[model samples]
Target: MPKVLVQFAHPAFSRSRVHRVLLKNCKQLEGVTVNDLYEQYPDLYIDVKREQELLLSHDILVLQHPFYWYSGPAIIKQWLDLVLEYNWAYGPKGYALLGKKMINAITCGSGHHAYTSEGHHQFPVSQFLLPFRQTALLCRMDYMPPFIVYGTHRMQQDAIEEEGLVYADILSGLASGRIRPEHYGGLEIINSLGHGAMS
Candidate 1:
């Protein structure tokens, strides 16, 4: 089984509807570690050594956050900048994350159609996530397609709960090795597999 670490960042968690349930579901799993960034570092002070150690210990890294302004919240960038140092995460001697896997689990306010070229964003959500992919590549990690919950702005409570269940299923699959990294190849989004498909 893979040791999965979820770096969960939500600036306004109190106001969150989708991530709240998702977090709760992930917590119930056996081998998943949920690291709430804002909750851990409210003052924005990150422990680089500890973060690196966590990365070294985990097999899979999951970046879970709401898609803010086509990217993640400020803390996500801060964590990356402070924790992923030269000669540690990248460069010649930066092999701490080599062979590890990364996946973005993001919640979007708009529906999937809104991220298409003909829609409001005028680009796919995958395009906006290129930086994350490059970062994973630089660290020699396998960057998997993202798991997304679309149209959260108008999602009903039952629908959000269902998405939470799906999120749990995906995490469980990844941790248990039932869902391999190659399963995400050539895929735009993880949720397109639908609930229970990965398992």
Candidate 2:
């Protein structure tokens, strides 16, 4: 099975209802590592060497967080800016991350309609995620459309639980190569392992 790495960041995980549960579900699956950024680096002092090593070891990279102000939390951006450096994650000789796979698993407080052009946010969720997709592309990694949990503002217990299961199953399927090729069409990445879609 392909090893997975989830770079999880949430400023207020103690108060989070959705992300925490999702992390818990992922933790139960073997071969999936959830790296809690804030918990690991409370002082914002990231170990670049260790992080790079972690990236090299994992086949799939997952950025898991709650969508805050249409972007990620401050620390996740910090991690990207620092760890994905020159001659390392990007640039001429920076092929360390090349041909890898990346995807986001996020929770949105608003409904799906709120993210459309005719809705409140005035753009699609995919549009708001261009930066992330481009970053993955720049690193030569396949970028997959996010696994989104929408309508969190009024979600119930069962819905959150179901979404969590779906997220975990998706990760498991990616690692095990069970999801089919046809499902990869509008997807962001193709598993170089000849599995299915990128996780």
Candidate 3:
């Protein structure tokens, strides 16, 4: 089984309705390591060497968080800035992450329709995630589609649990390599439809 490192970032997990459950399910899964960024770096002082070491130990990396302001939380950006060094994750002699798998798992406040061109957001969710995709590409990593939970505000308890199960399944599949890279036209498309596979 592939070792998975989930870099979770959430400022208010206790008050969260969706992210908390999603993260909980991920923890229950085997071969998955949940790295709570906020918990580890409450002072915003991320240990660059430690983070890099964790990344090197995992075959797959999962950026699990809520979609805040059309992107990840500020800590995730900080992590990118500090941990993914030029000589390690990119540039010449920076092949530590090459050939590894990367994926995002997010919770959105709006429904699927809200992220469409005709919807309030005026662009697909994929458009908002291009930066993440490009980041993985720059590091020579395969970026898979995200496991998402839409309509978070309107989601009921049972619904959240169901999505949690799906999230767990996604983690399980990815860790076992059952969910191959680019298996669902990238994370944006896979998330747009709950079920993912080759058609």
Q: Write the per-residue lDDT of candidate 2 for residues 12-56, one digit (tens) a residue.
A: 999998887799998987788989999999999999999999999
- What stretches of model 2 exceed 4 Å from their correct place? 180-182, 187-199
The local lDDT score (0 to 100) that residue 67 gets in candidate 1 is 99
* TM-score against native, each model: 0.97, 0.91, 0.92
Return the top candidate by TM-score: 1
lDDT of 3: 0.84
* Candidate number with the higher TM-score (1 or 2): 1
Where does candidate 3 stray beyond 4 Å? Answer: 182-188, 191-199
The candidate 1 region of ten consecutive residues with least summed lDDT is: 190-199
Clash counts per candidate, in order, are 0, 0, 2
> Candidate 3's residue-wise lDDT over 37-117, tens digit each?
999999899999999999999999899999999999999999999998997999987679999988878888999899888
| TM-score, model 2 to reference | 0.91
Candidate-wise lDDT, in order: 0.92, 0.83, 0.84
